[model samples]
Every structure is written in structure tokens, then in C-alpha cells.
Target: MTTEDERMARFARTPAGQRGYDAAEVDAFCERIAAAFQGSTMLTAAQIREHEFAAAAFGHHGYDRDQVDDYLDRACVDLEYARRGDSPHPGPERLSPRDVQRLRFSAPPPGRDGYAAAEVDTFLDVVAATLAHAGPTGLSSQDARAIDFCPAEPGGPSYYADEVDAFLDVVVRTLTEQEQKHTAS
Candidate 1:
């Protein structure tokens, strides 16, 4: 059987490295340390350092600030659970990765639609108010001429709607294609 040192070396070579230990072992260690720290309102820098050492030993190693922040956040969450006498194990009760992905891809919320509507109304209202205040000075002669001659609908030859729409369509298409390419990768 491979020794612990050999296992650690092999783990370091893998993509997951030291942060991919069996969940049960990781959870148990977290629970024990959390219980020890229970009822403490705040941790000193030394206490944080000691917890960081224990975290590294428990396979939560990371070099980047964001990764370290996430590890620390999870540590706090586990501590809170332990303090409440909750099960320390991350079991089937936890949301699956597939569920998380589904939520991310879900349609925008109703509040988002309301926000968009409000923004568009505000923009149009501002434009209208500016035109009203300027009377005719705000508009160039060409703009006034176009307003007088152009068809009320947006698709006449005098109107630039088709060109504007085409440009917007191309932008949307390019962005969607880029997103698809990244998701495929």
C-alpha cells in the first residue's frame, strides 16, 4: 500500500491536488475544530492562522485570494452548523452540481423584467423631456427634416431602424456564439 507521503505526492500531481479528500474525513475534521471554537465571538489573527493550518491539513489548500476566501467561508459555514448541533456530513441533502447548473441557466426573474421596463421608460421619458425643453434648437435641421418626412413606422426608406436593428442583431448573435463556445469547452 502507498504510504501517506506517497499519497500526498500523488494527490499533488492530480488536478484536484490536496483539496479533493473524501468528503467524510474533511467534514469530521471540520466538525471537531468547529466544536472546539464554539461560543467564540471573534477570532484573533493568531486564531485565524491556526485555523488556516488546520484547514490546509484538511485538504482545503489554495494559493489564490478568491480560493482562500471560499475555503474560509466554507469553514465558517461548517462551524455554524456544528455550533447548532447539526450533522457535519455533506450528504445527499446538499444540492447537486446539476441542480446548481440548472439554477444558473434558468430564465431571468420577474423583478429583472420590471427593472428593464423601468429603465426603458426612464430613457424615453428623459429624451422626450429634453426635446420638449429645447423646442427646435436641440434638433439639427437634418433631424427635423427627417422627422417631418420619414414614415411614422420604423421601416420606411427614410428611417434607419433596419440598419440599427441589423447592427444590434449581429452584436447579440456574436455574444451568444461566444457564450456557446465557452460552454462547449
Candidate 2:
């Protein structure tokens, strides 16, 4: 089996270019990831999966965002599964790769009409408000994290699935941790 050092040494460094992500930031993040793999850092899979760097619109060449993001996705998945295997918790699941994409949810079936735009929007608004802890009543941090939504009716004012999935994953993580604490206590 190839050693961790060997595996990481093969990482392709991104080229500097314009309109790409900041090379320094990307490199820094990769270093952290490598450290995690070497058992010297405590970074989590979610952190890796959600990592973002500002775009580099300044110079001639920069690290490619598509390549970086794809690589990160693979790394995050590998790390998540590895960690999950070590956890005592049952049924641990990782997010699907498609979950991060800007996907267009399918529309209503053949003859069926779309959901009522007003009601759908209202529901989404409520969810957003609750997640943001805006109103007097909202989803508990755990509920926010655990909550999942199907794609909105593919007609009027549909929300982006990728955005909602990402937000809800964060929420679920928060809520699940709280639940674990409560259970332990």
C-alpha cells in the first residue's frame, strides 16, 4: 500500500491563472488536508467538503476552481468514509457528490400541474427563517440539520437545490451534535 506521504506527494499543484481561485488559499487548505491525513490535524470532512476560497481575478493564471473542487470532493469523500469506519455510531452517511452541484429539480409529471407557487415559497421562507433563528419559533439547531426537502415543483420560483442542501447539511450537523450531547447527558 502506498504511504500517506507518497499519496499526497502526487497531488497536482494548480497552475496560476486569472479568474481562478486564489492559489495561496488553495495551497494552504491542501496543506491542512494533508496534515489531517498524516494524523497531525483534526479537520473534519464537512470542513473539507465545504471549503471555499475567493476567486483569483487578478493575474495571468491561478489554480483551477473546477479541478480543485473536484479533487476536494474526492478527498472529502475518502476522509469521511475513513472516519466513519472508525466511529461507533451506526448508519453514518456521507453526502452524495451530486448534492453539491447546481441541479435543476425535475418538473411536474406529464399532465399534473406544479405545486402552488405561493405555498411552496411560503414553506421555503419558513424553513429559511427557522434555520436563521429569525422568528420567535424556529427549528431547533438539530431539526435544522436533520431537515431534508425534496426539489420544489419545477415551475414557478423554484429554489436552488444545491444551496438548500448545503445549508441544511450544516443545520443537520449542528442539530445532531446537540442531540448527541442531550443523549449523553
Candidate 3:
């Protein structure tokens, strides 16, 4: 078995060998990643990130989807960092205020309680600065969840709460990753 094949084997198999991701599909994808890592293929990091996989469900056993996704993410990140000669230790991807503002969401209808759009915008502004190392707030998921939004004025729209919450999760992940890297150094 190849090294990639061996790595794939490390993941937990389906119970009693039931339906899972197709073995051939998994093998081909792994081969591509292996080739990229070994300088045999020109698979760009963006391609790695955007690549889609076919669902493998049949009488034969296959790999778990979650495990495959996790590994693929790690592999893509590895390739990106490798290409940039990055150590993923000291530097964090600086998210700009504009980037935060550009996060698209469907506004809630009038007369309904939504994530106060203004409050979320202000918080995102702060998050942008924090990510850029220009702010003091160590925002966490809990802190984000604690934030309350007021009802919108009559016929006024507010940001969707679930979308805002999902964005906050991304923010927290970015902040914690930066902090951990800094601390490790």
C-alpha cells in the first residue's frame, strides 16, 4: 500500500463495513494530494480547497466523510503554507474591516427581532482590528453568544441572527488561532 493509502487506513472504518465514501474515489484524491506534496502534480492550493468529491455509497466499504474532509483541509493548508514558505507559527491572516463588512447576510423582515445590525457591524469592526492586532478585546464564542440584539424599528430590517452567529464562529476561530500561534512563539 502507498503512504497515502496507509494514512487513509488510520481513520475509523464503518461499523461492520457498511456504506462509506468510495474507496476508488478516495484513493484517486489521495493520489492527487500525494503527487502535489511530492512535486509531481501542479495541484494549486485553491484547487485543493475548491475540489469536490463524489459520494461513495455501495455494497463495498468506503471511508468516513468527516475524516476525509478533515484530512483534506489539513492537507490543503499544509500545501498553502508550504508554497508560501510559511511556518503557520507567528503570522495570522489579517482580516480587514472591509472584509467583515462584505460578509453577506439576508436581512430580517421588519417587526421581528434580529441580530441588531448596527451592533454586529460594530463588533465586526472591533474583530477586524483585533485580528490585525490593533484591539484589546479577546473575543470568544461565548462572548459572541452573550451579545444581545434589540428589536428593529417598524419596517426596519436587521441582520439575520444565525448568519451573524456563524460569522462569529469564524472570527473566534481566527482569533484563537492567532493567539495560539503567538503564545507558542
Give the best candidate by TM-score: 3
Clashing pairs in 3: none
Tens digits of per-residue lDDT for model 3 on 1-185? 23353245445556555666676777777778777766677876456545776655656556776777656655644555455554432212454455564455557534445666677778877676665553335565456556666655655557755455445545555666666666677
Tens-digit per-residue lDDT, 1-185, candidate 1: 11121122211211345443343343443344444555434432223223432224444543333333334443443343444455542421232222212211111222221113233233334333433343333323233223221222222122122222222222233334433544677
> Which scores better on lDDT, 1 or 3?
3
Give residue 142's lDDT in candidate 3 (0 to 100). Answer: 55
lDDT tens digits, residue span 1-185, model 2? 11253145333434654477777777788778777766777876556655778876565466766677655655554454445453221211332223223122223444444444344445445555543443335556555544544444555554434333444444355445544555677
Order the candidate numbers by TM-score, best to worst: 3, 2, 1
Q: What TM-score does candidate 1 get on C-alpha atoms?
A: 0.22
Q: Which stretch of 10 consecutive residues in model 2 shows the poorest summed lDDT?
A: 88-97
Structure candidate 1, residue pairs in collision = none
- Best-fitting candidate, scored by lDDT: 3
Model 3 regions more than 4 Å off: 1-9, 16-18, 88-137, 141-185
Worst 10 residues of 1 by lDDT: 99-108
Candidates in order: C-alpha RMSD to true structure: 21.9, 16.6, 9.6
